[model samples]
Target: MSARSNRQIVLKSRPLGIPRAEHFEIRAAPVPALQPGQFLVQNLFLSVDPAMRGWVNAAANYSEPVGLGEVMRAFAAGRVIASRHPEYPEGALVMGMLGWQEYAVSDGQAIRRRVTETDLPLSLSLGVLGLNGVTAYFALQELGEPRPGETVAVSTAAGAVGSIAGQLARLRGCRTVGIAGGADKCALCLSEFGYDAAIDYRQPDLPDALRQSCPDGIDVYFDNTAGLISDAVLPQINRHARIIVCGTASVASWDPWPQGPRVERHLLNKAARMAGFLIWDYEHRYEEAIAHLAPLVRSGELRFREEILDGLEAAPGSIADLYEGTNLGKRLIRLADR
Candidate 1:
């Protein structure tokens, strides 16, 4: 293969809230030569996630903010086209922080894992077989500890992680209720993802809808949106209910820390437990989760969705679109074919 220039979407300016296309700029640069123990990756699929909102914000998140003029930080799946590294040899597929560029040079430190499931689409490594899937697996099982016949309520139930989490809960014999933005997504939650009940949070009577769906009260709540959705769910927790804090997609900024109904009293009354979940915390157990989820995906026992946008041009505004719920499923920008 011949060498070529790399195209990257770099952060042009920091945004106060949701980042738009104007905040980024596309630039061409010569692909860096591989150094000792380094490899060159031709990224095929770039991920667009809600967590990206925090990555571009001025506020410090779990990881450092993407610096100005740098390629936008993201998880991508790709093939190693050139290599000096023995482990990540040429032709090996990899997934990790490869950013929003067509080509990435890595020393393997930022590479999360090798794409071992060759039978699955390489794109799945960026979604269900990657961080999102592992996150849903660990957070729900370890933190929520849901029991059979219990009621499991999931916010953003039509999204990447929530959809998987809801399905996992259902497979465990728990009754699953999904909370989504629109009626279409709510319907998807029921028909596609197998949620027993679906609630449109955009409706005026969210609390009423939640109450009706979770008649026995919520035994476990997988919270992806932490604003109004959580407000309605918290008050309905059953005795010893478990709450998993996954993502804060609804709230754009946490600068002043958006205020809402206090949850101390609710937890005290119900003897409930709420814990935050970050996928990085469970990095060591990623393969374990993948081992369990892969077979289910292959057998069609587990279902997943993907919305692909062609070319790097889609990279700039994709994150904003994610927050607006424009995509039906896990969103990815296709830069090349695997």
Candidate 2:
């Protein structure tokens, strides 16, 4: 019989700034025959994340950059089609760092967990029930510590993590305000995501908008884009506010760093605390988060949106699109039928 083929996308070079499609090389190679203790996963969905930019950059980050000539790193959900390992049998659905490929060989190290919630779409394993939801769950509950009637302001409020975080804050009795790029996304934040008010950040005067929307000042600022959005929000923080730094999407580059307003005076005046959060730090509590979030998701209390592309080839450009504010929600690439 002819050998089975694998379609893969590997990093051709490290991106100088935001990664572009030219930095990746798509190739088809013979799928390896699994050895003992190994399994083969036919990836069904590949997650494209904003964090991927940092993953490909040479600069120091929480995780090492994807090496040249290696498969582009990604989170994915797939089913085992061939298995020589007992723990992962054929047809078992799993989620892990499956990279940008139609198939992946696993010795089981990168697997985060096997998918157990069967009621929802499998693609959701990469969204609300996955890292995005987990990030929102812990980052807010642990760091934000929102109180009843407190004001929680979230940047990128129409995106995956921000949308979920805003909803979660609402459930906790905080008045939620969302800051998104356009009027449409702002409407979604109010109508769909349950924000008390939504601010369109594309406006010329962001500081004035923030002041009008958050008249009492922000009690918890969930900062996803830490450039100008943060610059405006910082000045409106209430006394003893908690600022959760989740992402830096607004800035084009972070190498030499972009110059902006200094925050020392604002933080000092408000007695506010600003801290960075990474989901991996709470890895041990994955199931704990799932337990709380899965129910909310199932009951329709926690809502999410996804923007899916057609194939593996669409993966590279999707990353660029995400940074460009073109993606509507959690961006993903569908590789096969679930």
Candidate 3:
């Protein structure tokens, strides 16, 4: 085997609400010999996204369920160790849905980005420069439509998507407020990401704190948490405000749906518009977004943090950890020996 073989994290069962270790199985597998039109990729980075929780359950929203006994699905970046296809040569790096494994055989159909000029980091393809970044960028431009001098707020403020969203809003000259779970994340939001203000959702009263943070009413609410944390801010929206419904982190447990404040009166009072977005729906403009974001990242205006586990055997539990807010920014697993 070109890379470490005999390793995988398989789905033991579909999760109920918060996932447990019993939902996953780590196993050994022999690396099959490569043949014509086939390519063997040595996994380098595996992503653990919160969306994986919904994917592990019954089909809801937009994404499909993760079939039983399948290698837990994920986006990953890796190097080609053995290739039999004309275009996919050995030693080339590619990014795709490589699943939770140290090694995988592909027909080259899943290959997304063929690592060429970009020498940033292979792990980034699974995190900031990849799906998370695109999702954040799209939700802001399409849903929030932030304007200069406006006040913008984001939930999940220190997370992968939220971090980028705050920076983008700030870049547009918006007064940005971030709502994260803890003081540490709130500090990171304000100090590291330069958000104008940040509120710890763990506080006793979220709405009161949000009121103090945004004294001038929220102009654009980039919501990542859709329960009480979101409801707390709804009553304070500005007239003609835009509410970008990015993700509902509070409902990540996949359990009995959470109960939040009824905000119909607040919407009537503010006349705000709330819109939900799906990342894949913006695929046609993906490159356009990267074109806009890449230079900003290169110019040091944007930063990314990743909490990476060392092997594929940790993929399943790492995914469960994501929903618990254990990951600082982007959660990833490194399959290659670094």
Evaluate all candidate structures by whole-model CA lDDT and list the values in order.
0.94, 0.92, 0.82
lDDT of 1 at 129: 94
| Candidate 2 weakest lDDT stretch, 10 residues | 1-10
Residue pairs with colliding backbones in model 3 are: none
Supply the global lDDT for candidate 3: 0.82
Q: What would the TM-scores of all predictions be?
A: 0.98, 0.97, 0.93
Error of 1 at 215 (Å): 0.8
Pick by TM-score: which candidate is best? 1
lDDT per residue (tens digit) for residues 153-190 in model 1? 99999999999999999999999999999989999999
lDDT of 3 by residue, 280-316 (tens): 7986676777778778877889987888788656766
Which numbered prediction scores highest in lDDT against the true structure? 1
Query: What is the lDDT ranking, best to worst?
Result: 1, 2, 3
Off by over 4 Å in 3: 1-4, 33-35, 252-255
Using TM-score, rank the candidates from best to worst.
1, 2, 3
How good is model 1 by TM-score?
0.98
